[model samples]
Target chain A: MSVAQATRPPKAPAGLTHAELNALRADFPMMSAQTNGRPLVYLDSAVTAQKPQVMIDAATRFYEREYASVHRGVYSLSQHATDLFEQARAKVADALGAGKDETIFVRGTTEAINLVAQSYGRSVLKAGDEILLTQMEHHSNIVPWQLVAEQTGARVIAAPITDDGEIDLDSFERLLTGRTRIVAFTHVSNVLGTVNPVRQMTRMAHRRGAVVLVDGAQAIQHLNVDVKELECDFYAVSAHKHFGPAGIGALYARRSILDAMPPYHGGGAMIRSVDFGGSTYLDGPARFEAGTPHIAGAIGWAASIDYLETLDRQRIAAHEADLLGYARDRLSEVENLRVLGNPSERVGAVSFFMSNAHPHDVGTVLDQRGIAVRAGHHCCQPLMKRFGLPATVRASVALYNMRDEIDALIDGLHEVNEVFG
Target chain B: MSDLRELYQEVILDHNRRPRNFGELEPPCSEADGHNPLCGDQIRVYVRIVDGKIEKVMFQGSGCAISKASASMMTDALTGKSVQDAAKLFEGFQAMVTSDMDATVGDEMGKLAVFAGVREFPARIKCASLAWHTLQAALKGAHEMVSTE
Candidate 1:
């Protein structure tokens, strides 16, 4: 561990245990599934986490029993719909340690990022302004700024990631200036799995008079994120990356900043009134959420929050830490296969390139044995270019993944070596 | 080894290790780059045609086991074959990848028979046909094309 990691807060919060994690997995029906007759060992949680039965049931029940357009109709059912929608918002806000007014619902992390880019970026950013981002960001975080920069003639600057996969805070400090509008990067890298020091980075950005936006798609489910504690001005997350249903995410902005930004998409729900002269937009969050939001998905997302509550999430984090450590130890034993970004504080993500065998062959071979792992660039093409590889095989874990699965993965790695031999 | 056998065959790994018919050809002929950015597979097929007959066919670039193997197989299959004949071969091989029946592709694909098994793995269709597609584009006389990204 580096000096920075040694001083950084421990990976997980206090007070979590094993009985808790097992119960958490029991809540998810997918945990009990079999793919090709073998238990479905899903290790692609960085892409999307498995949905729990409770969240699924919550979504289905909403459609089956309480189906109505919210905030529109004056009927009893519509009122019920509106109440459920707002309650879900409140639940998510509580989960993220944010206020309801600060959270704006969108489709997923991608849309959440586009929301910030179009609203805050387009409206506030002027020519010669700079948007600072880390090289470890997913394309979602990197591209939106590019789009805004292209449109506004603003320059997008990159903060370098050190060889160990952590962001070079010195490089970040150098990139900062009065003209740096936004510093948007991932809270935890999806490919590298390095948990960034969000609090420290946010404070740094704040001192430089810049708003920081964190792509929490990878971190929201894994960490106990307190946006208030981090003092992050804008935080983006996708529900699917957590244990919730797909197509639901939230962009949490400090109330003042969200109020300052313009509406992203022009639509019916977002407008207070429309006349020939111009349309008056609704206040703050409603201004950001233009179309009909993910109503059922939001309700299900709330159920996911409820399900996460059952397991002390801190314990789940610790259990994953142990599994991650065990996996790292086992995988490192494999000859000629070097794990990418073996950070002192890595989340449950392992990206590695075989010395002789290409990653596609490795992924295919793994798939043949009923073990599924993501192959290729993992959507970080720039990161691929940084590492000077076309792609890599990635295995990411979640709360439900067990020690035996790690054994299976180790066996699979050896299987790859044997095949190549 | 037998079950882990089909997908990562010795021939596939061999091509991945020492890709046949590799390296770029100078311009003045047709060329198309096939890229699968998802898997990070890249291939460039360069063609030399004389009187509508492909007198010389060579390919260059790096990719995964399936792609490199498929490229070597295609180059070996089409070296003496004409542009028209190569197009037909490309069509037949594409059916093997896109079509649901594995036997149809396996039986028809002569030297490209190794890729027939890739038909079973649908996600790898891009990998199997990356070289074949570049060949088709080259035959159609498209130039400086980059794909797969």
Candidate 2:
């Protein structure tokens, strides 16, 4: 079949029946939302996934029925709340094939990376040490390392990506020297959707005695990520990137590595004993988690994981891959529009720019049509600089997204072209 | 071709396609950079004022069609006006773009009334005003970058 004919109306592979996917879509109330006079076509899941009704209900139930602070009170409500909160940590660990003690609940991937850099990085890295990173890392992954490197007198070196945006494996391996103390990179690029071979890269880094931290913020939502299988020393994921509440995420680190790191934040709950001389700290996970955590957010995150457990992940991934291919094919047909990367394996996100229209203009026009997209640097200014672009318009897919939404996005781009022309 | 068309008027598109006074001025120019971090719109405004009148105005940066067009139209409107007059016009243009739809757009604003449609898009007001803010900074002889947060 001709390219246009094949891509114009893309079809999902026969995974879950149409009714099943529709029922799943029905779980998100925002699916029926509108802007101006058009139905909402949410193509910005990379920014934040729309929470499902289960997540809302879970958080509401915690507040309405099981409302209390965790880990401190002798009261029954507090005890119950504590159990559920800790259970949430277990759910995050289970999702990543990690032990409960290996996971520390934090506030999103940004905070998670900061915790690692400040605690683990400061403890291990010394003067003249090197922290190697990939070119496609989000600002969250890059900035934290830079801060830690500055403090420890270490330097951050970036391994380059190929022209099509895949991690240059040879360059990455070469960059892993004796002085390389840490190797941090994104599991999947937020802007390009390029899925790095985390297993292979982690092994390579480990061979050179460098600790690897995979920023799995963009990976866990769309792909089945197992930190154990990847064999990375640390992995960070945000619950909000999936169908969970905001302000909560998880960091998975090896038990040995966590045991060696110091406490990142000094506050209540992270200490075991207080004395005038000094304070004794708690164990690994507890050592990192200070202050009262987001209790409701954790419960809601567990609920999201529970909801994900009901779906066939392989089937969902297949459907997402099909959507990505179809989107690339269809988007190519738009005149003067350039889809940013042609990675061998891309996931949910696609960044593109129309030659005649700036990303902000395109984003504004799309918003008017009730099609939401992320525009600008997407918290990846370094990557934008690598591509010689100031910004791009990004449309990211989720499990609930349908081919109709892609059609709507294509229609919105046509409108943008008309307006700009 | 409704509210959107109003926002992206032919005049605005024309200015975007061929922005006027879009280059750097040599030394002896008062210049300031403006940034709207939300959309990554960056603009540098350069002015050569003589006897308090804007003898020449130019802008060099990359941004959206609205931002580039707004910068282009702003330079054209303020080139021959005094610094105080330019500030007044900037205030009027800002009010016209951000205020109520029925807010007055006096003939003093001239071609800048096209940005009145920005009132409908609250997020784009910064895009339409970056160059103007930079212009204000230039007039004040401020060296720090101006940001429309």
Candidate 3:
């Protein structure tokens, strides 16, 4: 065996058994489903992870039993709803290693980033200022900064990634000059699965007097995120990427910073006082959250966190690492197929190209066999261009994915090769 | 499986491998670029219109098999046809691809019928029609890029 293979962790460790981990699949109803008369093998968790039954049940129960507006109504039901809503916020904050007051609820990572860009970015950035970002950021991370920069007469600069799909730290530090106001980068690349050195990068930016924002949409599900440990000024995440409900995510900001930033939207829940002349906004998270939020979605997301906490996170991470290693070895054996990057530290996703077929065609062939993978630029068109590829087929592994699924994906690629030949 | 096979038939694959009129036309009378941001599929449709007829129609770009084949077949179907006839053919092609399986294929569709099975994959409809949309934009003298969104 290769040294890489020799060092691979065992399937089951001392505490959590492999059987126990496999049993967690039962919580997800879609695990046993069949698509197009074949057993479904989902490998598109990077797009969105499937929710557990507990999360689904929590959302349904909220709608069926505890349906009421929060923070306004005073009746018993309304009070209960308000309590649950706040509890959900607390749950998310706890999972992210943040304080409840520092957490602001938004639609998803996109909205969270937008809120920062529009409110904090507009407040701080001036003419000739720069917003530094990495090349591997999702469009959500890039476009919001572009819009804010355009409005503020600031320019958005990108830090280049290494050939192995990692941020060049020396280059990043050099770019963090006196004029860079904000630096936003992904904690884990959605396409290449490179787990960035967030803490080190944040320290580097802090030394240069630049505040950092970490896009943790892909990392929150796969890794334990502690904002205090990373020392990042802001962290954005999406619930759907973490086996939680869609339309709900949270932003983790330092309490002082969040308190100082202006409101992102204007509405009933976020105001301290309203008048004919003008209005004043509330403090903490309420300042950013403007409207009646996704109450059920927040509750469902908290329930997902609760479910995730039940598992040994270390074991889950190890299992995913093993799966990624196995997938990398297996896929590399395919003829004329090339995995996009070989980052020293990567998570459970792999993006690859086949010489004989376009990514869409490969995706279709895989889909026909009930194997779901994402194709196209995977919303990293700039990175795609950097890699000199129009598109790539991405197979992302979730906790529920197994070696057999990877085998199925490899078989499907063989079929793609034969058909496109 | 049959629907998948029908969507990517041998003829379609052949056109993808060797697309007709695949390069840029020098100093064309009119041209328009097309882009599908979702897949990064890009095509530039160049046309030479004489009188009220399409004297020449060609495209240059890189895309998936369906998109490349659609562009090639469209070049064959539109050349030597009147401008109004090309518009009608665009409508027919659009209807054929976006319509349900039960929708009848028009006899006038001819070679364009190869894309009728695109209805099975709704996401690919944009891929199959990107060049046609660019062609329409070119004929309209609208130099602005066309998008499938």
Candidate 4:
């Protein structure tokens, strides 16, 4: 056997074993933290994951020892810093099965989507053209396109979602027409935890001659993402959502499409030559990347990717699926609780409403018991409106989460019922 | 649990369960809408003024217990009070929720002093004060919607 395989633990029949999961949990320092004199049960990973010690250390080590501006000075320290930064880019590209030249570092998914909506959407979209989006899209995905559409006099159209919260394939296909210039949607709904069929949707959009962008903010943590397999024109991911540092993310765009797109922001690093008369911009990813990048954040993100690579992704997916099912079942047992969106395949999160209390009230009670959950529109007000709910209480899971944490959430929810009953 | 009980006291829960003055006022009255965009809490305050006094005050909307109960109790307190007195109560309620936890509430607050617990939970202060802000807008003849962003 290969040395890597030989050293790896024997595969569990279904997900990680109890001891294995506990060992993994120890990697995250926040797992041991206490809130309100009770052990913290972090159930809001979908909002932003608690960082692993490795990622924290990686960023600290870089800032403390190897801090230098990349691609500028001729000194060895600057060269070393450049090498480390480029190595991080390579790791991000490899993680998505994308070309190194096609991956551009951004300030999380919002900036990435805004980059595309401005650079590509503005360049191609015309008056009377349509940019088709799904009802399940986060505000990040929807608002950028709307801004671009308004600028170009192009119309923004939303594809309907089904009662179960899945993007209705039939409705989506029908929305795509010859006038459609772009299609943007999320790989997974942050609130509902519904995983969309990106490959199928990409194929449909391609048939209509439309470029596709997939929001990977909620997907990268749970799924083994391969941009080549999904065949999407562009994909965006936030490092913070996947246990890395905040304010840093990566965008994977197809080589030809990225090559044709103009520079998003104008600054020093993106130029080939500069003069007062006229300046020339470089081709590929650097064209879109403008100011001094987040070097330490990239390093920390690379460490997070390395940490994830050490774990078997399939087993993690299975473990999260089990937790989602358990959460849904337990939430249903509550007398007045109503779990939203019975999507066929869900990951990471489960959103619900209790008839007896508003989500905010339930969230407050849960907070007192040291459980962290999200209680709001989740930045998808349109999606909340689709279900006719003001807000929902979202309990999200990460790899370190255990069944006991879920049980604690259940008990906290019971307390909410008692207080508001 | 004690902290929670402090925040969601029995009076607050009762007011939330069956809010007083819980409907829109008829025409010839001023009304203003309040919205907390973060949590989707919305309250619309309606009032009928007679000789610069609030002859009738009512509200209609959907929100959490804190917001709903605060609105319910606000209408009850504002009835038969002059616009100036209503503004003073708004100021006192806002101070009670925003002040330090141990600060003494003014006697003018009366039953509204229950919201002193909100000082400990800074995030809920906006929820407790959303209706008061709307009520102030209605009293000022500003029909524009107010948002606690």
* Model number with the top DockQ: 4
Q: Residues A28-49, candidate 4, lDDT per residue (tens digit)? A: 9999999889999999999999
Model 1 stretches with alpha carbons more than 4 Å out: A1-22, B1-4, B105-108, B144-149
**Candidate 2 per-residue C-alpha lDDT over A145-165 given as tens digits, one digit per residue, 9 for 90 to 100:** 999999999999999998798
Residue-level lDDT tens digits of model 2 in B13-51: 999999999999997988999998877889999999999
- Kindly provide the TM-score of model 1 when superposed on the true structure, using C-alpha atoms: 0.95
Rank order by DockQ, top first? Answer: 4, 2, 3, 1
TM-score of each: 0.95, 0.97, 0.96, 0.97
DockQ, in order, for the candidates? 0.73, 0.82, 0.78, 0.92
DockQ of 2: 0.82
Identify the runs in model 4 with alpha carbons over 4 angstroms from their true place.
A1-13
- Model 1, A1-421: lDDT tens digits are 3322433336564433556556767878888888666777777788889999989999999999999988899999999999999999999888778999999999988998998999888988899999999888889999999999999999999998887888988989888999998999888888888988887888888998998998889888777777887788888998998889898899899998888888889987888899999999999688877778889999999998998887755567677878788888888898889888766678869788888778888887777666788988888988888888888888898888888888888788898888776
lDDT for A212 (candidate 4): 96
Whole-model Cα lDDT per candidate?
A: 0.82, 0.89, 0.90, 0.91
CAPRI accuracy category, model 4: high
For the candidates in turn, chain A alone yields TM-scores of: 0.95, 0.96, 0.96, 0.97
**Number of the top-ranking candidate, with lDDT as the measure:** 4
Clashing pairs in 4: none
Error in Å for residue A88 of model 2:
1.1
lDDT of 3 by residue, A292-380 (tens): 99999999998999999898776887778878888999998899899998888888689999887899999888888999999999889
Give one digit per residue, the lDDT tens place, for model 3 in B1-149.
68778889999999998999999887757999999988899999999999999999899998999999999999999999999999999999999998988899989999789898898888899999999999999999998989998
